[model samples]
Target chain A: MEKILPIGEYIEKGINSLEQNLSFLWSAIDDGISWLVENMNDLFLAIPFVIILALIAFIAYYVKAGNKMFTLSGLKKAYGLTIFVILGLLLIYAMGYWEEAIQTTTLVIVSTIIALILGIPFGIWSAKSNTADTVIRPILDFMQTMPAFVYLIPAIFFFSVGNTPGVIATVIFSLPPSVRLTNLGIRNVPGDVIEAGRAFGANENQILYKIQLPLAMPTILAGINQVILLALSMVVIASMVGAKGLGSIVYQGIQQNDIAKGFESGLGIVVLAMILDRITQSIGSKK
Target chain B: MADDNNIRIKVEDLTLIFGKRKKEALELLNQGYSKTDILKKTKCTVGVNKASFEIKKGEIFVIMGLSGSGKSTLIRCLNRLNDPTDGRVYFKEHDITRDSNKQLLDTRRTEMSMVFQKFGLLPHRTILENAAFGLEIRGEPKEQRDEKGMKALKTVGLEGYEDQYPAELSGGMQQRVGLARALANDTDVLLMDEAFSALDPLIKSDMQDELLQIQNKLHKTIVFITHDLDEAMKVGDRIAIMKDGVVEQIGTAEEILTDPATEYVEAFVEKVDRKTIITAETLMFDNPIIVRFKKDGPKAAIRKMREAGVNVLPVEDNDEKFLGYVWLEDMLKLEKEKAKTVESALNTEVPSVYKHYTVEEMLPLITGHHHPLAVVDDEGKLEGIITQTSLIIESTRFDDKEMDKLIGEANEL
Candidate 1:
């Protein structure tokens, strides 16, 4: 009522001090991420698009058909996924935004990988210790539910504009599912089985590696699927803060009131997202 | 305590109280409070109360009680799966209670292993891999562990199931994998806590029999826990009956049934099939009336039968070898004819039983026989005689007073 809370000023003061003291640290992170994103995009573009198509198609086909390559039923089952992948990749390549799509793909891949590396361990810690779980749960909730746009501010302050901030924001938005689901998976493992492990003199590390992690694989895989999808969704929002790729194309198209450009570039993003999503989801679901 | 050298595991005054107020509960227990009273006052359940016993090597020491009895907790203490609130457990000469984590792990991996009630096999793992879990944890090489695991699987009659997942097996088969897992560790002690309680009666019986057969060959010191009195009788060399977390009595199944130490124990054995537990050696009469077939005449046999008030006298050679029986009526007729030895009047068709033959087994032999059945040792030496009346009386009453008198008479053993 009387401006008793000056929460925004307090945050601004903190941010100013952090930026003044940590500029060196921020630039280093910024340079490292930018280098990573550029190289990864260049690598994606350098690979023959046809080989990439073939790889995706091959993976999609095998997801449907297992080791039985020559079997008629397996072939019949494989054709659907293979054709879908091929068509999807061909459409994205034919679109004039192939390079931008590849750039977006690189950002998504890099962001998802980083998110998982941090999220999985956090999840495992939360699952194992009640105190860690209590402390982490609210933080994870904040990361997931705080507006994706709000994240760009701090992400930019920390790493500056470009793919680094975009990747940072994407990681923040997508990280919660991995942490939450990994914790769920490990916690859901039957207690008696764990008791059995302890009964047999299985040490802490042995129990985690042999019993907990293996049993939790499918659920962790599902969490990874969610992370990838969330990172892809952040592509357009990331474009608002000077991120590259399909998101930037769509952003310009909207500014210019060019409906055709916007929808076409947006379609390219959909095609890419669909291919990656189907592949990852199938991996988790595979027997 | 019987022989120090052969004691595999000795638990001394072990108490396990389960709750936050363990110290208070223990104090109340020490002050002679009842278990329920302790629980009411401190909100602590006494899992085991000053349970003390010695498990002999190569014998099945069963801890038996109903659900909520401290049997499961007591067994867990042997492996330190559940640490005691008080007292100590000794393995060989070492105090297991004082063992460091490394020593306890070594004990679990090399000296003792446990089987669980729920079959605790990993559903994701093959039967062989689950069986080899203990070995793998203890740092056995993959090849050696697999070989031992496979061998252990065969021992538990799960050879063909080695590659299959636990979900593929029935409950009983899953439990065999559990057994094989412990067996693969090659430990001397096997602590089974309600290991077969989850199985149906028929499968449970098969597992029990198989356990006994395996025990016969391996001779591992097994501490088995069961809610079933019958199973305790079937598997145990000696049993400790528990109630309200206190050990009621520890003795052989026969001793518990024939001479229960507490009312709670008596309640548990009330419906138990007595014939399966009462053997000829326990029910037979020692120093029975007998006619010497080598030198005694029919008149001597008649007089012996008359004095003993028996319809027949068992005929034994001078060597005390069981020959047969002679009917008192036949001996009288033969005596009137002045027959020399009782051998002519001997009824060699009488049924006989070994000393260890159970009353259930003796029932079929005793139905129509007028003469008593000879209870003999392996060498056919007459140890005692079991009459149908003694068999029926002892089997029906299921008490020790009659057997006590007979045992008192035969204190020579």
Candidate 2:
């Protein structure tokens, strides 16, 4: 205890340094938040691309179906999914906040992409080797069990602030489920299937791609669904780090003590969550 | 087809140990060390031990034992699925143990295909896809793969089930799909590890018949593994009876049934019904009384019987073929009835069977009929006699307890 530096001097030094950099950090955060708010129009513009991509996929599938039953089933599914998406849009419109909802959707899509890119390889690597599985498992457990707020703090520290920081926070919060589920899916494929692949003269890579991954697709898709839900939940918490979206509106409503505003924003989130959840679940169940 | 006499797989002193420090531990354990001591010294299990045998080309060579007899492990070792911890496995002229992984894979894909006990169909794939899986992996064109797959499926009597998923098929159908998968590859060697054991007994017998039919057409070298002795006898050209990872005896089915080399083999064979395995050919004498038929006269038949010094003579029609039998009593009766009809003295109660009838079929005829039945050829001519006494004698060939004790002692040595 005597050899350690005095607690008062340490506290004083920390305060002096914090004071010196506090203005810089605050201004950087402000600039990031302003950049996100200014580009809200661009985020809204991306919604048309999603609609176009969906329509193109639907048309491609529709033209390829030769059988009446298949074609009818495809039309039914397409109409059902379209109705779900329209209902979701109506819920957002009902809140009278189209720009904020679009921003939130953009952030979710980007963060989910990032999570998938990082999580899938980790899952594959874990499936390849027991050592990698053992090491990554505990880390995945930690990431999943650690509170969402904890991810936001570190994300804010690293990326400073803004939608990028918010995306980072959401990625960190949602990534674990995808990795864990992918590993589970690959590992749970029946032993006889793997043996059959081997007996068919498949190399390790061939077996992994042809047998393991395809068999694991449903479970992996379920995991992706979980990641989407987790990312949606993080959007509001990310507002505390100066990120804009529906989360910002919710936060503002909270500050001003406006109950209707908070409820509307929250309801919009719920609608978005339900739509994503249903789509992913339908895909998984079909498999 | 390969040369029938050439040895396709020669397993020499093969051993498989499952765990760490396997070789040294297995040696110590084999040297009579206690299990606890062996465990403390080196943690391993002896899955197979010094098993040696040769499977000839185009033969249905069965490896039979109870569960845990290492028969499955031994079959896998031939293809190097469960690599042996020691000794060599030669696939034709090539040493499989020394072959590179690529060579082994190539051999497995092209030279041999294994049908697992559980069928091992890719559950996600339909029957056609499952059957075509091997060809697809080998990079065959989709059209050719489907063509060969369909042909193979048709060969296994599964032609119309191409679109059905594995889950939609019954167990026997799934196993047929597995067979089709193996056949689709057109490999020379087929390894069946209890391939039909999971099916019900009735289905199993049907599958066995199907396998035999396929074997007749393909003449592929097959190494079958099973615990059921009857199944082995029904299908195996030769059999290896294994016990506790050691080969108890390896011989032709007839040789092993008639003369088991060890106590273990004898004990294993004892429970098997002997009559089912032995045939009339095994018990028949080469020479018997031959009688040609011309004129039907009781005095002539009596004179021929006296000259031949036999009590009975087979009577044939004008073409010198089997008509039936005429015994001395029948001849005397006929002599007494010489003034009467010739048909009145014919002894028509002679029981007979085909020369190919197995001992099992012949047993009841001999015991129930109270007479040595004549083994007739395909044309009903007398081939030989298969008596109950001959069958009993054949069965008691391994009855000497001294021989069993000697074998047990030899095993310890």
Predicted model with the maximum DockQ = 1
lDDT of 1 by residue, B1-413 (tens): 45798999999999999999999999999999998899899999999999999999999999999888888888989989899999999999999999999898888888988899988888889999999999999999999999999999999998887888899899999999999999999999998989999999999999999999999899999999999889999999999999988899999989998899988888889899988988887888898877888888987777777789878778888788888988878888898888798767788988889978998888888776577789988888888898766787766773468776766777866
Q: Tens-digit lDDT track for model 2 on B210-291?
A: 9999999999999999999999999999999998888899887778987999988888888887777877887886456644
Task: Write candidate 2's Cα lDDT for A82-183 as tens digits.
Answer: 566666676676567667777787778777987999999899889878999999999988887888786665456545667767877788889999998999
Q: i-RMS, every candidate?
A: 0.9, 1.1
Model 2 chain A weakest lDDT span, ten residues long: A60-69
* Deviating ranges (above 4 Å) for candidate 2: A1-85, A148-154, B1-5, B29-41, B286-355, B363-371, B376-383, B388-413
Model 2 residue B165 lDDT? 94
Residue B80 error for model 1, in Å? 1.3
DockQ of 2: 0.52
Every model's DockQ: 0.72, 0.52
How far residue A121's Cα lies from its native spot in candidate 1, in Å, is: 0.6
lDDT of 1 by residue, A1-287 (tens): 58989998898899989898989988887888899999999898999999988998999888778776679998997898789889987887888788898899999999998999999999999999999999999999899898988878888777767889998999999999999999999999888888899889888899999999888989999999999989999999999888999999999999999999999999988888888888888778865
Query: Which residue pairs does candidate 2 place in steric collision?
Result: B275-B360, B278-B359
| DockQ-based class of model 1 | medium
